[model samples]
Target: MTSSTPLPPEGHGLPQEIIDTIIDTVSDSTTLKACTLVRHDWLPRARQNLFCELSFPPATLRGEERWRSDYEEVLRSVVMDVAHSNIKPPLSAAVRRLKLHFTDTSSELGFLEITSQLPFKNLHAIELLDSDLYRFEDHDQDALFLFLRENPSLKELRLDGVNSEPKKFLHFFSRLAGLQLQLRSLYLNDFFGYHDDYHEPESTFLHSLPLLSNPPALQTLALHDVSRTEADIFVIPLLTTPSRFFDLSCLQSLEFKFPFIESDEAILKMCGATVMRFTIKGIAHRIHDGVILEKCFHHLSNLVRLELHSVHPDRHGIVLLLLEHVPILRRLGQLSMQFVKAPSRVRDSSPPYTSAEWALFGEGVDSKVDQLMQTSNPSLKHITLDIPCSWKNVTEERIREYFPKTNSKAVLEVFRIQDS
Candidate 1:
């Protein structure tokens, strides 16, 4: 009798070490599926890469099943076993990260059941995306709390497109307020005050932070869509008394998705001692006149690193306006504005610092490099820009005209624009 077993293709016959490398290198699902067929040896690693972190199709679509793509089928089989009490812990254990975007209430109910059954011990990260989080949020507080208590190791959470009365969430966060979970990173984006609350309370949720039993000091926190909250209560009062329960004193890095004039100042005023990295995105404003953010930047009293990214390069002075506000006067900084992440189409034309393509954005940015360089009592060691190659034809003497290399401490001028 002839042996009927088939052999893997020649390249697939490579040493197990090299095959493992190939499996480990590719994270895209299609490639991992192809690897699974190559040899039995690579199947474990390939499946690990393929199934570890899963994203359902956008829940914004009409049906719940629509979110399940390729690997979700495997997950369903494991969920069925777990639900039946013939649980295979290792199967659901593979799912360390899970993201659920719910288009409707039924989807939330379905997933909560899945969550309860899975008892995913390794589930350390969870993301909930729902515009109508209100329907399920308050209704399922007990189950949600059970999910949290069961998975005490959960360290990161992201809530996006959530608009609710603060009180509804307090029930959930109150459970979390105990600070039992080692939650280090939190992202609250597009959270709005309840639209029906014709009488918006002075600050119900903002005051609840510190009360969470001195909630775990989050190392990373990002606050987005501050405008959704009535007044600046959500962002500004974080550092003040009576409402300071949200416990940000352990913060190491913070990002502002929506720019507020006094927002940065508010955090520093409350807990500047611990924050070393600060980032602000002003992309919210199409016409970013420096008037509002000028004071915002001025409040950078403490911090070793600051990142300021703007959408309107036309208002290049917006960054300079911020640098002028550094009241500390003599702290070292390397201001980099050309790092704006424009799309490939925009990058093709919008050279970092100087671009006429941006003339359409607004009047092109003011040449405030000289103005920023001239700001008094400066500790600026370097300034970086992405000026156009076309603009590089200017004589070196003219370059020196604006940036004289004669400060007591010579400031380094770095540009992507090549020498003419």
Candidate 2:
């Protein structure tokens, strides 16, 4: 007699390669877990994909928690296991990205040692976020220098609350000059102060960055606070090097969040029409002007997204000027304006000039924005208007009226009266 036909396999039983593709597309961790249970054959592929990104909450110390006492006992037992050394093998082999967050100075060296043991040769990206950083003592500085020297294959580097003498930063960067590691992105956040608290030799480390023998293949550079002065001699190297980056075609995003007292011309020229995303924060009135920015936009016709913060009303004329000058900006997808309050005068008028106020806002800002939208750029999508919470003169009604409704089906949103 013929045997009963076997039941059809459960699910599609997708090929192993197709499963791997599905894993790669997912960015959220929760979804990865569900995928793992699909089948025994899919387990290894799911695990490898999920563990590729390792995030360390470095702020938590070894003995900070009372519960950790029990944890430590268990941890020690696991470390002493016969196969403990093999633990790094599978993890290191799959990890391509690492995000580290540290809160204390005491654990800096310990953190370094832990990272050194990890297999980082295949690592491509690293993001460092430190809530509290130690003012580098002599030894701490040396250890950091050594860590960078060892991790020469790094393609992307991000740092937050990193403290060091400017000279030391330059000294460390100088060593990596010849390696020419494929560094495509650089992000740095440092405490901004008017004075130089940490002293170093006369040889300023800030200048030494551009002088590196072979600049890393940088495509995206973000500097939160590099300097405070308006001196061109100091700001030129950082702002004027887009063309120099390897595969200049890849350079698209640039950010200058520091307080700079200098010209925007070089920055405009360096971008030279190809820059797509640009962000500028903390502008000092005396050093920069609207006209320069207008010219910059003229040159950088490709800019698609712009974020402007801490700008004075007088400087607003610049953004308006830019809207008129940059033809390509009509395609701008997102625009954010972070405005500071204009000092108020005690107006004793009986009735507030409601009509005048509306007219003024409409003629000045609203009209300019409408004109920009009329331009042919199809990409202009979202606009966020951030105004001080205390500005009583610009009422909610006036703001709503100023933002003309577009037929784009909320594809372009306009927000007003954001919290200061």
Model 2 TM-score (2 dp): 0.62
RMSD of each: 8.7, 8.2
State the weakest 10-residue window (summed lDDT) of model 2. 346-355
* lDDT tens readout by residue for model 1, 150-253: 77777888888776554555444545656444888888777776645535464655454455434566788887766634335443443343223356766787
Error (Å) of candidate 1 at residue 205 is 9.1
Pairing residues by index, what is the TM-score of model 1? 0.66
Which residue pairs show backbone clashes in model 1? 209-245, 209-246, 210-245, 210-246, 353-386
Best by TM-score: 1
lDDT of 1 at 22: 78
- Please report how far candidate 1 places residue 74 from its true position, in Å: 13
